[model samples]
Target: MSDIPLIHFLIVAAALFSIGLAIVVTKKNLIGILLGIELMLNAVNINLVAFSRHDPERLGGQLFALFVIVVAAAEITVALAIILRVYGQYGTVEPDKIDGLKH
Candidate 1:
């Protein structure tokens, strides 16, 4: 099998990050923003695992990527709960429309 170039992975990661950033910036829904954030984190994970491949012994980057995956999972759980609660209260997930809950 042919070896993949690091630049290829880097380019993909950069594209993912840019698309994610755009989603985060332009999307009105909180869930969409969360998805964008996930995309960005996945891009970073790709970079980490790709780099780790070069260091056959250490695998530190890959381990860190796993840690990140766990953290992201937990974050999604919490964020989704918050989003659902907000939706229940306000009938919407649009960030601009939320403006905090009243006392």
Candidate 2:
């Protein structure tokens, strides 16, 4: 079986990260931004796993990726909770329209 090149993994990861960044930058809704962040995290995981493949003895990269996944899950849970609260309080999910926390 032919091995896939590291460059190929890097390119895919880069593209995923870029798309995620664009989504985060252009999105107005809090949920959209959260989705973008998740994408970016997944991209990092892809890169980590790809590099880990080279060193079969040491599983550092894969270990780190697993940690990242756990953290991302926690982050998203908290983020969604915040979003839900914001939506309930303000009646809108758009960050720009939320204006003040005092209200």
Candidate 3:
């Protein structure tokens, strides 16, 4: 495998995290929020793998990244189910318009 500088990986991760944060903050749809969260998780994964590669004696970061990936997968399933249920009940996925719990 060709070697890559750590800083380059970190920069990419930071960019992904920033974009995901913006999407999470400004998006109205539940699915959009979920997508943002996934993006953020992927950014974290990238950092973890990059760090682990530099210290191959211990694979802690890589293992942790694997766990994060598994957790994100589970989160996607549950989040999509919740979003679908909310959309079914209200015919909308916009956060501001979802006020059914207040009643």
Candidate 4:
């Protein structure tokens, strides 16, 4: 298999960031926004892992990235719990429809 270039990684990261931003901006559902955030985080992880390939230390960026993954998982759990509670309080997950907390 051919080795992937740095430019290829950068291109993929940019695409992922753009898509995540678009989803976050256009999606009205709370869960959709959460998913977009997760996507962005994953894009960051890809960049980290790709760059870590060059580091002789080998544990620098990649180890931090593993911590990031754990933190992101915890964040998803908390966010999902909050979304579920909000859904139980309301009938929908649309962001604009959540007016109960506005006052």
lDDT of each: 0.94, 0.96, 0.95, 0.88
The TM-scores of all predictions, comma-separated, are 0.95, 0.97, 0.95, 0.91
lDDT of 4 by residue, 37-103 (tens): 9989988888888899767577677987898899999999999999998888887899899887741
Poorest 10 consecutive residues of model 2 by lDDT? 94-103
Q: Which candidate ranks first by TM-score, i.e. highest? A: 2
Candidate 4: where is the Cα deviation over 4 Å?
A: none
Models, CA RMSD each: 0.9, 0.9, 1.2, 1.8
Point out the worst 10-residue segment of candidate 3 by lDDT.
Answer: 94-103
Task: Using TM-score as the measure, name the better of candidate 2 and candidate 3.
Answer: 2
| Model 4 pairs whose backbones collide | none
Candidate 2 collision pairs: none
Q: Write the per-residue lDDT of candidate 1 for residues 1-103, one digit (tens) a residue.
A: 6789989999999999999999999999999999999999999999999899878899899999999999999999999999999999999999999887683
Number of the top-ranking candidate, with lDDT as the measure: 2
Candidate 2 lDDT over residue span 6-46, tens digit each: 99999999999999999999999999999999999999999
Q: TM-score-based ranking, best first?
A: 2, 1, 3, 4
